[model samples]
Target chain A: MGIYLPIAEISVNVFVLLAMGAAVGFLSGMFGVGGGFLITPLLIFYNIPPAIAVATGANQVIASSVSGVLSHMKRGTLDFKLGGVLLAGGIIGSTGGIYVFAFLRRLGQLDLFISLLYVVLLGTVGGLMLVESVNALRATRSGAAPVLKKSGQHNWIHRLPLKMRFRASKLFVSVIPVLGLGAGIGFLSSIMGVGGGFIMVPALIYLLKVPTNVVIGTSLFQIIFTSAYTTLVHATTNQTVDVVLAFLLMAGGVAGAQYGAKAGQRLRGEQLRALLALLVLAVAIRLAIDLFVTPPNLYSLSAADLN
Target chain B: MRAPNAFATAVVLSLLAATAPAKAQVPLTEGIQIGLSTDNVSITAGFSGADLTIFGSLENPDPLVARQGRYDVIVVLEGPPKPVVVRRKDRVLGVWVNLDSETFENVPVSYSVATTRPLQDITEPNSYKQLSLGASNLYMQPADAGDSPATIEEFTAALRSRKAATGLYSENVGGVQFLSQNLFRATVRLAPNVPVGTHKARAFLFKSGVFIKESSAQLEIRKSGFEQSIFRVAHNYSFLYGIFAISLAMLTGWLGRVIFRKD
Candidate 1:
């Protein structure tokens, strides 16, 4: 079936979009990520304009994040205070990112900038996760316990001024790093159409020393609002959000997510992380290749300064 | 004197007789007229490219010339004009970047041409340039005239080729056929991504490779369907639309979790 996307002003196969969404959703569920990072690039590869892809990806992230957050809320692993502080910074950063997005679009460099950001960020994050997971897996196979970071170990981040205690995570951390991390993720969310979960989860674990149990829930909690804000801004300013496209993806994503979550339970954490790392690395490599390869058509046309 | 006067009268009579057929040989100037059944066409969401048939007539056409296939007609459907920027990507530090750009003002969003014969066979290329009849002949005015002629020419060629590739600018040979000496039907293409605005349908008449007359009509191509309504809402009431989109996402998320809870 074919459906016309109002904002994108194009007709795309409904089944292709649904399947793309389902595949991304399955991975997101299996990996406990928002899936925005995957969807935006996939949409671009599928020939959706990068601007619309980014905005619509942000819109679709809300559904998966909300679904994930609900499970976390029920389990009582969510840190509301930390999530709230992150959200405060996210709104500000997202606002700035939207301006930059519009500016780059006008300059006709938004696509390049988006691809570059994805390649750099995803490649680094994926590489680090792969190495860490492989080491952990090796340790387990050798009948040795995996070395864990002590929660009480003090880092420079803990020394920062104006520290606030997060009761749920059982930690006192400076508001500055928390707010800064939130702001960075927020920026990425608006610009890259990602919930920044891949970055946020690891950052929370290593940088902020947030407890592993509460990290995913708290990251997801903040991601829901940040992406929601990003969607609203892109909609109002760029008018690029295609609800029809977003809806189809969400429908497929939500259904696939449930089954994926069930399937994920059978896998060990290290194996799951390794698989997700490979997936991320693959996407990053794909995007990087496009940047270097010669495009068939060098000349492109667009409406001049669409108002 | 009588002989001379009679000779003069006879000469005058002969002159009048000789000039009579010459005066009668004057051909009537041909005129063209096109009419549309409706001023507006509403295209639904499933609108792929379709051929629009326009009925027209040649007024005061000479039967002898029409029979010889000397009468040619070219019909063009031009969409609304808008400013467009064409950018060229250049390899920089192993990455392709949009490095150069040229902007053209009042470029037609779409132009589709239908002709009784091939454009080259119907008339001289100079005539096409003079009338700006075909897509290739249509002048694209650069916003910055200060740019070098070579650069402007390059960009203009690029723009036209890109438009042609996208099916926005097209030419159909023998798309116009004469039903009778005076009546003709033209079939012009409307691309799937046709711009929604007032489109101008123009027909040009040629007699023996000479420009005779031209007629034009206006058509409003509107996208009318559920998708169009959503587009309107998104642009007109963007704030509310944004809120709605967010709410819809949240609803879908909550519902999906409720319906398909794994734990």
Candidate 2:
């Protein structure tokens, strides 16, 4: 069955949307990454208008991330102080990102820019994860322990002034780099229509040396806020948020995330990471191919009033 | 009875000529009149596409003017005008980028034309240009003044090709089939993406390479049902709609979690 989306002004199969949402949500729950990076590209490939896809994709991220955050809340793994600082930066970065989006859209370069941004982000993140997971998996199969990077080491970030203590993560670090990292991720995710969880989880672990348990939950906490802000900004400014499409996706996404979190517990960390790496790589490779290959038709039309 | 009717029409024509001086250019509809299959179209939530049929009838008051079924009728449907921006891409650094662009204001968002025969077969090129009566021939008003003629031509061609490619603009020769002696019908398919507003449906009567009579009708295409309400809310109360959208997302999330709790 299909329904018409008023904001997108297109009729689409509701089942297809639900399936996509479920698939993305499952992957996100298993890997602890927001699925906007997957959903936005898939929508674009399906010929949905890029603006509508991006805006509605952000809305879906909010739904899945909220569910993820709630589940983590009961476990007491989230660092609210750290998440608060990140959210403060995200709000500022998202505001700036919307203006940049408007400028690029006015120049008719938004599609090209969005595609290029995805190619770089997914390519780098996917490439790093693939190499690291492969090594970790091999070490595990050989009955060898993989040596993790030393945590809580005195890094350059500690030298900055205005140090603050994060009781949950048990770290005392300057807030400057933390805020800047959060802002940069927020800017990228908002413009790319993601939740910044992929970048946030890794950055928190490596850059801030936040505990692995704290990273996933705290990242999701910030994502819920950032994605929600991005959705509202796109809706008010661009009027591209398709509430009908968002709801349909969220319906399958939230349910899928619940089951996926359960399924993740059955797999080893190395195997799960390996699988997530493969999934992210697949999306990255697809986007790269689209950029490199010649399109069948070139000319396109846009209207001032359209999103 | 024929003599009395002709005399009365002449008297009425004289009176009209004295009262309406500006309408002297268009002759009184002495040849053809058009009636649409339906003038008002409501695009409900389930609307995918619709066919607009124009049924035109030709009448010859003067026996000497014997055109028979040779009269070619071309019906053109032009949607409401909106500003459209088109960007042309070029290969730069082995990647395609939008290097040049043009914006055309007051351009019909959708234009569809159907005719009894080929456009060239029915009228002179001069009249075709003067009337601007075909899908490809719609006049484009360039938003920028400094653009050269070459750029204007390029932009106009790009606009026509893009709109035609999307089925928003089209032309089909022999689309208007004559059912009988003086009756004809033309069907124009309005794609689902057709701009939602009043569309001008113009029917032109051409006989022996001369424009004889023309009549224009308005067909309204507007959103209805659930779709209408959503579209209105988004455009009218955008901020409120945004908040509502977020709230909806959160609600669905919470509900999904509650329903599917493993514990």
Candidate 3:
């Protein structure tokens, strides 16, 4: 029942790992999320080192995003022009993030830093999303269609330079905002192991006003390359990515996502958003508590002490 | 970057130190027959912890030393070396954070010692230091040894306690039990978390507190089957391995869509 992870150098139960992958996959399917945020924290909670957890989580994201993108491609929904611009920034940002990751690891503050970063990021993102989704749900219940952000609305993003036309999304917005958004997500991808869908899909819908139909596909496309780059960086530089652990997770994740995609059709947009908001908030709350709570083992030992 | 392991460091140092040879003394490897239960240990997925029994015989020909009970047998096992970093956590804004740290380079990843009797009772301080009989007597130099404010004593204490806690570095004073007048066997416990590499097991024979012969054998602990292939690919060809991982994931993702179909 136990499988040894070659890179992680530990033995974990195969069934338990599969079940965990299924649980996270189910959430991703239900909420249109990558579940990296959930899985990485769970791995860390189980005593897997933060470095390995983050790297392997990114590896899984590459799998999830690839399949998600393929389905979108079949439907001809991806905005390749838009995805390309973002990917250019993403690659650059991720490469830079790895150096920062290596530096923090050497100083032995990577673990604490990762936890605090998650607490802050998840708290802010989850809190804002929950408030917005709750109000949108309330509007739907009152027999009013929740209003979607309209295109061509003048904003700060519109005023930026380096304008480019994205034919598929039918947007002529400036490339600056797209690049910045891509860079931010790419930076987070290496450190946090997320596909950045939770952040990206929402940004495309509101900030860039991309068509909702194409937003998910475009985000997945960008995620595929970004996380793949992150995986390579971690493997070559930090030597932290565990291929065996990633393989087990992807096996369960790919299968579970099929069921998840089918289940997603049953819910209304606002209802689904509401559920996702609640789930994100719950994870954020858990992280917050861990930060404030006194850890059982304050002193951690690392490196080697053979003699 | 994945730092070079302790074995690599030791080999380089030993080669350099050999050129500037130390004091001439009786080499420790006199009349001893030693065997490990399995010289090459294969670590499969089912590997937890293992017990390594070092069975050896000593040819104690000197009758006077045996009559006086001045003969002892010490068996030691050492894993490949790597740097160890120990840090003290301080409360910063109510969240614990690592502040000060000391790094000890070229220390064994794991070291286990078993002897017929207590190490201290068998040898004097000068003799023990020269032989490196005890764990504390290792030549583990702190990176900041000569620097101000970073004491060697503090770093070594942290290193010793931490390794002891993990069962990596241990000492069994009476672990080496004798089956007969010239035969002895000792069991050294290795934790599951022990690093995988070439380990060294050494046995020393002493008489009347003078230097004697020592015999050493190699113990190869490597990942077996699929784990072996995976470990080699990851560490050896990491860049290609990364690409392979991504490709495999993408392939599975695509295969999933093909098999499951749109429901």
Candidate 4:
């Protein structure tokens, strides 16, 4: 079925959009991520204007993050204090990012900047995850115990001033790093339309030394609000959010997520990580190729006004 | 009846000549007029592209010239004018980037033409240019006239070709047909992505390859449906719309978790 997207001002196939959402949702559920990183680029590839794709992608992330946060809340693994601090920083960072986004759009350089950011970030993150997972897999195959980082070990981050205790995670960390991390993710969320979970999870685990059990939940908690804020800003300032398009994706995504979670339980931890790493690498590589390749049409037209 | 009609025409012609004796041998000048059934057209969400047929007539066409197929009509439907920027991408450090741009003011968003015959066969190119008729003949004014002429020409050609490729600017040969000696019908195309605004429908009359008269009418094209309403709300009440979008997302998320809980 065909449906018109009001904000995008384009007619797209309903089934194609639904299927795209389902596929991304399935991956997000299997890998325990918000799926925004994948959806925004996919929308661009599907011919949605990059501006609309980024804004609508942020809107879609809210549903998935809320769903993930609910499960964490039930398990009592969420760290509300940490999430709150991160949110404080996120709002500020997201505000700045929105201004930058608008400026680049007016300069007609937003598309290039977005693709470059995706390729660099996704490529590095995916590369690191793949190597780590593969090493763990080899250790298990060779009948050796996997090496683990001791939770008691102290890092330079712990030495920062003005430390605050997070009771739920059983840790005392500096407010500076926490706020800065939140701000960084918030910036990425608004500009790239991602939850920044792929980066946030690892940063929490390694840099902040946050407990593994509480990391995902806390990350998701902050992600929900950050993406919600991003969506609202993009809607009010740019008027680029296409609710019709976002709704269809959410419907398919939510259904696919449930089944994906069940399927994920059947896979080993290292194997699951390895698969997700490969998927991330694939997206990054595809975007990188587009940057280097020649486009069919070099000349394009737009309204004189940014709208 | 024919004899009396001819005599009355001669008497009127003589009276007209006596009043303005500069040219005494000429008959009444041919004039064209077109009419529309409605002043506005509302297109629903499912609107793709459609052919709009306009009915018109010649007021004083000579029967002998009409019989010989010398009277030709060219009808055009011109969309609302808007300022547009054309950008060109250049390869820089192995990445394509938008490097140069040109802006044009008051350029027609779309132009669709319907002619009784091919444009060249109906009249001289100079006449088309003088009348500023047809998509090619329509002048596009640059916002910065100080720019190099070569660069302006390049961008202008690019703009027209892009418009043509997108079906916004089109030409339909033989789309206009004479129903009777003085009556005619013209069909122009409206593209799927047609801009919503006031469109001008113009008819040009030609007698034996000479421009005679021109007439025009106005039509308001508007989008009307559920989608259009949403668009209006998003732009007019943006803050409320943003809140609504956020609320909808949250609702969907909460509902999905409850309905499809795996644990």
Put down candidate 1 lDDT per residue, B68-182, tens digits, no spaces. 8999999999999999999999999999999999999999999999999988999899999999879999999999999999999999999999999999999999999999878
In candidate 2 the C-alpha lDDT for residue A82 amounts to 96
Highest-scoring model, DockQ: 4
- Pairs that collide, model 4: none
DockQ of each: 0.65, 0.59, 0.39, 0.70
- Residues A123-202 of candidate 1 have per-residue lDDT tens digits of 99999999999999999999998897765898798999998999999988889999999999999999999999999999
Judge candidate 1 against the unseen true structure and give its global Cα lDDT, from 0 to 1: 0.93
What local lDDT score does residue A108 receive in model 2, on the 0 to 100 scale?
A: 86
Q: Give the distance in Å from residue A114's predicted Cα in candidate 3 to where it truly belongs.
A: 2.0
Native-interface RMSD of candidate 1: 1.1
Q: Relative to the unseen true structure, what is the Cα RMSD of model 1?
A: 5.9
Q: Write model 2 residue lDDT over A1-307, tens digit each, in one string.
A: 8788898888889999999889887777777777889989998887788888889988888888888778789999999999999998888898888898888888889888999988888888888988998998888889987896766567787789999999999988888888888788778767888988888888888888898888888998988888889888998999999999889888888888877877888899878888887888888888877767776656667885434
| Candidate 2 lDDT score relative to the true structure | 0.83
* Each candidate's fnat: 0.84, 0.75, 0.70, 0.74
Judge the docking of candidate 2 as incorrect, acceptable, medium or high: medium
Per-candidate TM equals 0.95, 0.92, 0.88, 0.95
* Candidate 3 local lDDT, residue A216: 89
Give the 10-residue window scoring lowest on summed lDDT in candidate 1 chain B: B21-30
